[model samples]
Target: MSTTDSTATCECARAVAELREELATLRDEVAGLQRENAALRDANERKAERIETLETHVTQEFATIRERTDRIERVGYTAVGHAREHAQWMRKHDRLHDALKSRRERFDERLWDLETGEIDVQDVIDAGTNDLPIQTRTKERKTNPDALRGNKKRSTFIWPEFYARSRKTSGGNLIVTTPDAANILAEAGVKHDNETTKRAMRFVARLSGNRDDPNHEEHLIRFEPGERGKSPARLVADAGEFEQFAREASGMDVTDSENDETDTQDDSDDIVGAEADEQMDTLLNATTEGS
Candidate 1:
């Protein structure tokens, strides 16, 4: 072989070796880039799943908020309408007041006539001159048509027997444990259902003015741990709460008396006068300016 030929062959061999090294380096770089792209794709998939979960949670929360807002709006509007109707009723109370005044004056004259032996007691009863007098000798007061229409309307809401018999000089807390007490409340139209009792107990608890106390139910009823049916279901209330509930629910006076037999005939006439005066005062107040 020639020397020039041998030198050219060596140079070609060296160039081929360098080209092979460059190709190997390029292949390593391409593999590393493929691994990195795979990792990035997995990260993006996980992030999308998280975003979808958050979207579902937010949608449920928004729906709950909207429902609660609608309920509050309905309750607020109903309360406003009730207040307006009460105001209208108060305006008509004045007409009843005038009629009650005339009735009272006639009652006084009749009583004077009876005391002076000018008229018999049976004649007073038979003549129908003493219809629905604000007295407590009977179990219930007879509804009188002779009274003004407004008076009749008001009477339908409030009971005359309860008003005449149950008014006390002062108020006190009530611990209702007896069946008699329950009967009195039921007769006056106050509901004693489970839901009503729960609401009433909750209200009494709020009267303490503390929101953090969760055991207020304990104060309302003496309960057995395992046997709820054996629990002593008692209604307890402060004076003001009792009066407010009694007047609002049945428009009747609340008495602590456990039985109807406690009422005597001697006090019936006096109760009549006192009840009439109180009724007159209530009528006058309702008719007051801007009432």
Candidate 2:
């Protein structure tokens, strides 16, 4: 218990103090590491939330874009259909114009003859210019006994050649039936189902004044009941009104009335047709621009 003992006690005390200090430093380092790990976990959670939000926004935007694209495609198809219809209308108008022009030329020739003393002007004016009728082997019986004295019979239809040429080959008498209406409607790019065809037939019958007088075969149109009552009655357009009625069936630029004396009517019709064409072009251009 002398000097050696005193030195050993002092060394032991110093070692103990050093061990305690090392343990404290280790605890501090562990605490700091735990804090850093917590902060990193919070940052990762926030990043995950942000990614989810971005994904949702992108999904919604994509859906909106898809819907817009579908709408645009439907509109483009509709525009194309309208354009086709307008083209058909223009063709019909051209045919009418040609027919009218030919008639005018014929009248001019007659006028020239009168001016050159080749024919009397009054006689030419008085002469009827009715179109030739369809030939029949058997003469129709007269309805009245008093009016049956003459052997000669006259034609009921006096329409232009264009309408007469369009007559159905199978019908006993030339006329436009429901199938004919459907065909004409199809040419104008319109869907001609049963309902639409029937509607058009009724409209034509009403317009032609044939509905009020069903028995009269001289009207512009005639509706005949099915033989043996097996099917619905069918409509037949008069040879005179056939072409005009076909145009009307399309429900385009045609009207029930026209004033030939109006100065701006033709110009207005042309402008309307042009405007329709321009609208179709605009729709196509918009589709191209989007692409």
Candidate 3:
């Protein structure tokens, strides 16, 4: 072989060797880049899973908290309602207690006065008289026109005269003849059915000397004039007996008692009198000044 040809062959062989080395380096770099990309993808997937798990936990926690808060609010509202009810009940209880206390005190005072004889039977009669209607005749006339009219056929109209004459009677005995007593007896009879009438008749018989003592049951029976009969006045005197009779007759207590009636009348009278007096005084003063 020629020397020039041998040199050219050596140079070509060296150039081929260098080119192979460069191709191998490029293949290694490509494999490393593929591995790095796979790792990054796995990391992204992990992050997505973690975020989903956190979101689920947060949603559940919020729901539980809301439920607990609602329960607390309901309990608080219930407690507040109960407190208001208790406060109202306490107010009513206090008012009732005060009313009962005042009634008890008044009753006690009355009883003490009776026991001490500071309040005599006559005083009771006077009290009853004070409670009676002042214009009884006027009231009776309004209620029963026939009673007020004088008729020869009616035996001189005895009831009105009897009531008028009885109004002037003195002491506790005559007090029973008052309109108040009659009204009380009538009310008792209405409330108690026949029981009140029976009790009153018995009381009258006792008071009329048919029975030995006024307090005894045996004294309650009325004997016909010579035998056994009921006395209206005697029956009216016993307030308890009359009340019991009223309950039996009417099935209730005498709600319109003389005391209540008197109080109502007095209130009405005060208002009317005040107005009349004011007007009268104004008229009189104006007349005098003009004169």
Candidate 4:
């Protein structure tokens, strides 16, 4: 063979070897790039999931905040309405305050009308007088309401016969124990059923400031731990709490309102004076401006 032809063949083989090496390097680079792309996709998916979770949590938190705010506003508005109504009643009843002999003035003068009582207890109950569960006595002054009353303070000194009365001048509660109170009610009236004791207990409990009940403000007498909780016992009266509460209702106690009159009086706002037209003629007088 010629020398030139042999040289050309060697050069061609060397060129082919160089091309093969270049192809192998290009394949390695492509594989590395594919691995990096897969890693990037996985990272993006994780970030998206975390964002969605945060959004859901924020939405729930905002909803909870709105609900609590709405509840507070409702309570505030209701209180304002009640206060306005209370003041209106006070103004309206003053129309006949100047009569020579008012119904209440006569309760003070029990001369000829000895047999006819000052107030009809049944009529008062039937009229739904603030829906109170308490049954106070008018024994002593016969005209006086109870110990809770300001001018009639000496009244209710002798409590109901059914209760275990406490004649303590320091003024303790007139109580009948939970079981005793229930048994007595059951035996007294044949109109009640098997659930009479339970119903009566709950009714009294709710009105007398049961902690769980929403009507904690309507505490006419004062009791604790209604039928729901562990201490299912009943309380007939808490003299101190009742005295303070009744005085507040009749617009007598205002020392607490001295600092910020509007705020404190508003805070203590509650509906009263529902016992007027129910033959409890003195109730309006007691509710208006007490002595």
lDDT of each: 0.41, 0.45, 0.40, 0.44
lDDT of 1 by residue, 1-291 (tens): 899999999999999998888888888988898988899889889989988988998999899989998998898889889888887877677667776776676567456545654333433243242222212112222223222222211222222222222233345544433233334435645546543344333222322222212134423112111235665444343445534432332223212112333332222322343444453333222221120
Better of 1 and 4 by TM-score: 1
Alpha-carbon shift of residue 123 in model 4 (angstroms):
41
Error of 1 at 202 (Å): 59
Clashes of 2: 0
Top model number, lDDT: 2
Query: Cα RMSDs of all predictions?
Result: 22.5, 24.2, 22.5, 22.2
Among all windows of ten consecutive residues in candidate 3, which has the lowest summed lDDT? 150-159
**In model 4, which runs have C-alpha deviations exceeding 4 angstroms?**
79-291
Once model 3 is optimally superposed onto the true structure by TM-score, how far is the C-alpha of residue 222 displaced, in angstroms?
A: 44
> Residue 183 of model 1: what lDDT?
49
- Candidate 4 has a TM-score of 0.27
- How would you encode candidate 2's per-residue C-alpha lDDT over 98-203 as one tens digit per residue? 9789767646754653465433432323223221111110011112223211111111111111132245555444455455555655543444575556544443
User: Whole-model lDDT, candidate 2?
Assistant: 0.45
Q: What TM-score fits each model?
A: 0.29, 0.33, 0.33, 0.27
Q: Tell me the spans in candidate 1 whose CA falls farther than 4 Å from its real position.
A: 82-291
What is candidate 4's lDDT per residue for 10-33, written digit by digit as tens? 999999999888988888888888
112 Cα displacement, candidate 4 (Å): 35
